[model samples]
Target chain A: DAGITQSPRHKVTETGTPVTLRCHQTENHRYMYWYRQDPGHGLRLIHYSYGVKDTDKGEVSDGYSVSRSKTEDFLLTLESATSSQTSVYFCAISDLAGGPDTQYFGPGTRLTVL
Target chain B: AQTVTQSQPEMSVQEAETVTLSCTYDTSENNYYLFWYKQPPSRQMILVIRQEAYKQQNATENRFSVNFQKAAKSFSLKISDSQLGDTAMYFCAFMKHGNYGGSQGNLIFGKGTKLSVKP
Candidate 1:
């Protein structure tokens, strides 16, 4: 919580519009992740980055894109917002390069696409 | 496929009482890590405790501890001397060991057990 902050804590947008969520970390951790949480399902990963400019797809990355051009910032973008995309998104970071790292999560951003 | 399951959806405990949340995981890898994360109303996910699969010793953190049965593939959280502040959503997580001596950077989590401590 101290090291992580997420922008747009709550948002409501129309369907077919594009959306972007930003996660900023002051810890300068090597691993930054994006996860979406829903009612019945557990936290599902959308994307993650191991280093600046090095990113990979996660379990639920179908409509999401990410960019990590810097060590402190990671962005998750939705190409076309949909009602199904409405959920709580969390950004987590860890010092993975240091090993056995624990993840620090942001306050989370709630997005609603109607 | 590795999956973590939390059988309890919601639980209630009196103040200063104790409660245990159950978690079971399916994984063939012997080398892995189990974690208990707590999410308060503030929506911040906090690491409550962790247990390395290889270690037989259970993890203890003051009023919180875990009973980790590797052979049984069960990792449960036990809250001793529970307080009102302890009410939150508890999640059980599984992290598989990575090859090439690197971190895989992903965690499999259960649906979460919501605990409510009543005064």
Candidate 2:
């Protein structure tokens, strides 16, 4: 356990609605990442943050946005939810402390769109 | 772009038996890292083992070991004395070597291999 927790472990909402997921960590890791897991596609990176205010897009960054104002919290928001966005989202943290950048993951959140 | 491939979609092995999962990757860069992650029914991703490209010797963690064939572009995981706890979906991932501030730390993962440990 990396002292990571994801809020709203499960959510269901109608299409076109706004949805936001939160990831909180106690390790004070410098790198935090968000990923979506789908059948046949495995886990795809959605977005990541390196520091308090620095962020970058990942392989699958469309339809999603993220922000980090503090070291312990990273938020992922779906501006408008869609059926395609229904999947399990995971949050991971890495310290990169002069060793292998092994990331530890949170429990994950499952979302459904109708 | 780097790509990781797991040839077997599903596999089964009896308890106490040994089983190996196959993974192959494509990368132009000479130095990088390979990892195997296990996701049980609970859906929590656990890091099984990791191998650094710069290291010639294979990496092992308890009953889990990897066969790293750099020239062949293959990395396989071998589980000895498999237990029911090993039943889960296994994923292979790749990450390129780069500075901490760059995108090289992001992991690209394979589809996954469903391993069933039979009683």
Q: Pick the candidate with the highest TM-score.
A: 2
**Docking quality band of candidate 1, CAPRI definitions:** medium
Query: What residue runs in model 2 are displaced by over 4 Å at the alpha carbon?
Result: none
lDDT of 1 by residue, B1-119 (tens): 78999999999999998999999999999888899999989888898998889899999999999999998999999998889999999999988876311235688889999999999
Provide the lowest-lDDT 10-residue window in model 1 chain B. B96-105
Let me know the TM-score candidate 2 reaches against the reference structure. 0.98
On residues B47-76, what C-alpha lDDT tens digit does candidate 2 reach at each position? Answer: 999999999999999999999999999999
Residues A33-112, candidate 2, lDDT per residue (tens digit)?
Answer: 99999999999999999999999999999999999999999999999999999999999999877368888899999999
Q: Which runs in model 1 stand beyond 4 Å of their true positions?
A: A97-99, B99-103
RMSD of each: 1.7, 0.9
Docking quality (DockQ) for each candidate: 0.51, 0.73
Residue-wise C-alpha lDDT for candidate 1, range A8-75, written one tens digit per residue: 99999999999999999898788888999998787888898888998888888998999989999999
Clash pairs, model 1 backbone: none
True contacts kept of each: 0.44, 0.63
lDDT of model number 1: 0.89
